[model samples]
Target chain A: MLRELFNSENSVLYHVGKFVMWQKEIYKKPENWSMYYKEIVRQMYDIGIGSLTIVMIISLFIGAVTAVQFSYQLSGGLIPEYYIGYVVRDMTIIELAATITCLVLAGKVGSNMAAEIGGMRQKEHIDAMEVMGVNTSAYIIMPKIIAAIIVIPLLVSLSAIVGIMGGYLASIATGSVTEADYIKGLRSFFVPYNVLMMYVKAFVFAFILTSVSCYQGYFVKGGSIELGEASTRAVVYSDILILVADFIIALVLTS
Target chain B: MIRVEKIHKSFGEQEVLKGIDFTFETGKTNLIIGKSGAGKTVLLKLLVGLMKPTKGKVWYDKLDFVNLSKEELQSLRMDVGMLFQGNALFDSLTVEENIRFPLDMFSKKMSIDEKQERVNTCLAKVELEGVNHKYPSEISGGMQKRVGIARAIVLNPKYLFCDEPNSGLDPKTAITIDELISNITKEFNITTVINTHDMNSVMEIGENICLLHQGKLAWQGSKEAVLDSSNETLTDFIFASPFLKKLRNAAAG
Candidate 1:
């Protein structure tokens, strides 16, 4: 009879409230600065270097596909050939590079974070740390989130560059655009504001993916099967939230 | 010493610990024994501040644990050390790193050389010397358990909690762990509490015992009291097998 009033924990609003409240725990002063520094370095290496190859691969393919499709669309229209380069560059910078790259990372880095933390939770490592007076939330979650915030933006930038190059190579190789025309298009309508938008989206998506994933793993209970579910949910929720945030960011930033 | 004043814990509709009032004495191996699902783990967690009580207060000496602020709780937790049921050694870290983690995290005044020396000293204490660089998976189960002990005592904590320290070990290793815990507690003069169902642990190093039955304290006393007490719950738990009953009868005769 008394449980229902206090325990509508299943609602989405409840989880959001909990997540918002949990932020305070994550922002507490560290027990030792050097320890957090070391952890941040380790997490930086793992999240940055670990996902580099996959990010580059997906970015290249996305760039190539965008260029090819844009060329085909422009063929029947009065749009100039160089507009392919302009469209690909703006598209990669404003949306594709940030969104797709993070979505991929949501699968790669997000799931990995979930499994690592979930495994620690199952093994009682988190409890052991808690007993030692280390802020498990700060020590565990902050490093990953910080590292992601720093590196994911850098990764998105790289993805943008690689994607542009992919567009160049795909269009020129397929006789869709000449090198001179493509180069001219790349130089045309270049907006520095689009670059800022990319960074904004990168920062937002990075926070979403890492924080959401870490949250899923941190609060996990029960056994191996539950751990697996948490890992999957980390990726799933991260992707969904990324898309939603992308829409909202697009609305706000473009407005 | 840690004292629970009228502690009661419940999970939704089910109450797991019903008014468990007890004090775990300092420098003694205080054991909480019970059958599976009898709430030994729940009680241990409550004592360690991992879980809060549904009602009543947990007193860690002069401090009230239930009402401690976040910073205060963390401050209090620094003096606490625990050996989890699975040892809970960090798999990614080397054995030395695992043991040295608390020191590394909290011991800002210590030099790297001092930290290394302390880690080595703890290893030697656990008789796990020379395996510093090896990960937890590379070591044997008993050795892992010792590494867990080494990690727990790295800070020379004032309060030590062990939850099933002998859950998976063989008899010989279990005895060794029990002796180590007992010695550590006495040497450091720290209040030690153990939650376990291992009878061997109960008879060997259980200077103080707490037997929980269906979330209530069924029996509490010294290790010597187990042999003389005619408590049905304790008897049924200790002499559940006929072989043990026969041995008890023969010894009595």
Candidate 2:
């Protein structure tokens, strides 16, 4: 009984420690850049292409809803009506569109990658690769990480455009702001820095999303039960880490 | 040549292998057989450097396998081939890709044509010539096992380790796998180490049988000698389980 308890305890510690080892392994070989790039392309298709429609639809609605809310309040003279255009563009594109879109992606792409790779690990394909002289790091993890990086940036850009368009439609319908003024408001703050910050956040989020999900999947144990557990843990952990990473990046960019 | 010297391995306090000492030679099938939980599997893992021994050293010729550097281990791994019990073929790769996988990773000198030729040759060796494009899922369990064997030997490894090569196969297919392994061992002159609980395998390809019992080497001899050995523990072990006893009885009859 004591021995079984110790074995389980040891196994838990080993898995946690193995996860950290996998994280460190990412930087162990810089020569794997090209392989990683190819992997990213594959992942990009899954993350971006698969989830494009939903992200776009959600972005548009968020933009329209925000514009409608702002138009109602701004017409009463508590705030200038021109500010409605700014609120729609800035809040939708800069904050809500970029960050929240990624949060949604964390559930979709992150969980999918986790479940797929977790299933592979549980089935022992990963060990089979190692036996055949194939590098597991290059053969498995590199592709997923690369795909996420390529896909997330494109998804972010798509969400930003759709969100602004949604705001334009809502503003036009409500008669709170003219189309020219809405276009002007978007062009006015076209701060290269703001655009650059969005790109930075997308890239960082992609890296975290892929890495954490892959890590959770790669180390999953037992049978179907552990796989289900891994999938859940991957989504939850990646979601939390994405928020934390976004906050850190936001602090860095703003300061 | 593979040399295991006084190897001790334990999973917690269970002590799966206690002082295992054996040498597997080239061009012969070395079989490790025992009842379940007799440490045959653990010993196989140790031989292949998958699981490290607690109190001994395994020398692949001169290099201490346990203490080798990562790069060294990777290099050594190139010389080794392993067939898992479940025929652990990668579901993502087709049989052709799986066979060519090691060649792509370890050999950059070969042209694509050369690689393809080698894959065909290996596929042919396992009698799986035209089924190259099939995925593990698309193939039968026996075919998957053959593909697993094809993949293992694709690199033309110096040492071949099989963990229950016939675990789930029918008796006919299982015997065929044993014969195939034996033929390959002779043809390539590779040091082939097999871990099995099958008495059929023990009688057929077991050029040297190491019977392990409760984490100890209960007996070690050839198939001919195994029949006449006076060790009571070995007899009880061989005839202990009903399945093996039935096999032995049928063979005698």
Say which candidate scores most in lDDT. 1
Judged by DockQ cut-offs, the docking class of candidate 2 is acceptable
Local lDDT at A109 for model 1: 95
Tens-place lDDT per residue, model 1, B1-253, is 9999889999989999999999899989999999999999999999998899999899999999999998789788888989999999999899999999999888889999999999998888888889999999998999999999999999888999999999889999999999999999988999999998888998999899999999999999988999899999999999987999999899989
Candidate 2 C-alpha error for residue B184, in Å? 0.6
Residues A1-255, model 1: lDDT tens digits: 445434577667667877899999999888888888888999999988998999998899889999999999999799999998899899999999999999999999999999999999998999988888888999999989999999999999999999999999999899999998888899999989999999999999999999999999999999999999999999999999999999999999989
Tens digit per residue, CA lDDT, model 2, B117-224: 999988888888788888889988888888888889988999999999999999999998999899989999999999998878888998988889989988998888
| Candidate 1 displacement at residue A96 in angstroms | 0.7
Candidate 2 on A1-255: residue-level lDDT in tens? 655544463565555566667766655553335445555676667777899988999999988998888787766676656676677767765677668888888788778877888887776677777665556765678777777777778888888888888989989987878988887777664567877888888888888877888887877788888888888888888888888988898899999
Show model 1 residue runs off by greater than 4 Å: A1-6
Q: Against the true structure, candidate 2 has what lDDT? A: 0.82
Docking tier of model 1: it is high
Fnat for each model: 0.89, 0.49
